[model samples]
Target: MPQPGATSRILVTGGAGFIGSHFVRSLFSGAYPGLAGSRVTVLDKLTYAGNPANLDPVRDQPGFAFVEGDITDAGLVDSLLADHDAVVHFAAESHVDRSITGAADFVVTNVVGTQTLLDAAHRREIGPFVHVSTDEVYGSIAEGSWPETDPLAPNSPYSASKASSDLIALAYHRTHGLDVRVTRCSNNYGPYQFPEKVIPLFITNLLDGGKVPLYGDGLNIRDWLHVDDHCQGIALVLEKGRAGEVYNIGGGTEITNKELTDRLLSACGATWDSVDYVEDRKGHDRRYSVDWRKINAELGYEPRHDFESGLAETVAWYRDNRAWWEPLKQRAGLA
Candidate 1:
């Protein structure tokens, strides 16, 4: 473990993606109080969701390095692990819809890739290995939030892959005594999200004067966590979290998809008339909520951004940064 004031060299996998990019930028931007002096090496596959433009802000920053590679490559992971003090694993195929269409990519990337990283980290004797996961691993909830102890019942292929990865990571810790911590976070929404998620997709579609797709009756509820808040929680876990333990991170706001759509329409200056009710996705989870009391009570983690203000700020970012997302949307054929 790195002592206080000691320079920490962290290898962040999938650092060019949505949540990973935000976390890396924030780490180098003095957003996390004591981590300003830390060095980061970002390893990304530059997949459709991984955009190099997202790291332009930190590209010139000292002590920051970028590498293009796949996490499933054990040789690459082993070489990289030698130079870093800690590993933050964020590399995964996470789109539910994409996984539904074809699960091979998700299984290979999320399961096999995580296993490769874990094996390399264990071999190198890394001090701390933080595996970033999702709340969807618990499947769905009817009325209450799921605690860390809840049995995983993943509904979608994406969530199942994540759950598998989580188990493998924890197994390494228990069997090999590796210092590993897992964080399962709620739905993350903020700037630079790849316009495929619900928040960004709706925001970008509405910005283009196009209709937004709403699945089913739009009554499926989800807890929304801002990317900034989620990053903060992950930082806390990296600093003080225990080994072989699971922590849930949530934004404390619960709203149905319809209610969320209503908010988005209002933010984008659109109306319900612009919403296109699409066919319900297969095996769609009704509601997902995580009980993050463990992280809150132990690490003093709490969401700093409320939904309304965060949503407005996010909308404004997309509105002003048309040059950033326009190309992405066009490439994805969403424009």
Candidate 2:
């Protein structure tokens, strides 16, 4: 696998979305020392979750470009890959509830789109393709944490599609010998996240004196990782991860949904009166935890943001950036 340097030309899919935009901004801002001067071309479909404003902070940085396009377009992907040395794939339909209601989009974007990108990368001889993935691919873990070696047992259509993409990505490395590295990360919460996601949704709702729905008993547990830390782990993987290997990135903080809701309520100056218990999501995982020791030992990856402080900061961001999210919520009919 070829290593990326300052002069490397990298393609980032879904760079207008929350996590992808953060990565692009970090790249241009020199957050990743190994990729300080790397050139970046972002190919995004500008889906509902993908807000162009997310990249506004670094839009004019030298060596940065953005192309509005879909990854499923084989010709487009191929043409773009020809100019890039590596790829960091983040495009996917990731909302579990939305996937349950309609799964075809998830399959097309997560599976077919991934296959299309991988094929293009292989043809273009692009090395070190980093596939960003989720820990939900392991399904519900009752106890302990899932290591990178765990068999994928995805429960939701969204996770299933992501799992399929993960396998397809690895298969390319195994059979065609593409330089593919996969990173499975825990739940992410931070600024610039679309309001449809849990953290932002709840924050925005509560800010408007609206009620938040707590599914089932709200006992479902999830490990939360700040977007910054998640991106840090990804940068480490892109810089030093071994090809064909999977790494789990965790924040080392586990909290039940009910507990999380309580914290959110407090953060937003709301009481339990603002909470409404709702039916649980179909096939909702009971808990999710990832063993991130592999990345820590291999790439010196460790989450820098504490959960309490991270959550508080996230709430503050949504509160302060209503101009950024209000229109998004109205456009998505989520308000």
Q: Considering every candidate listed, which one attains the maximal lDDT?
A: 2
- TM-score, each model? 0.98, 0.99
lDDT of 1 by residue, 113-143 (tens): 9999989888888868999999999998898
Pull out the clashing pairs in model 2.
none
Residue range with the least summed lDDT across 10 consecutive positions in model 2? 1-10
TM-score (C-alpha, index-matched) for candidate 2: 0.99
lDDT tens digits, residues 73-99, model 2? Answer: 999999998889999999999999999
**What ranges in model 2 sit over 4 Å off?**
none
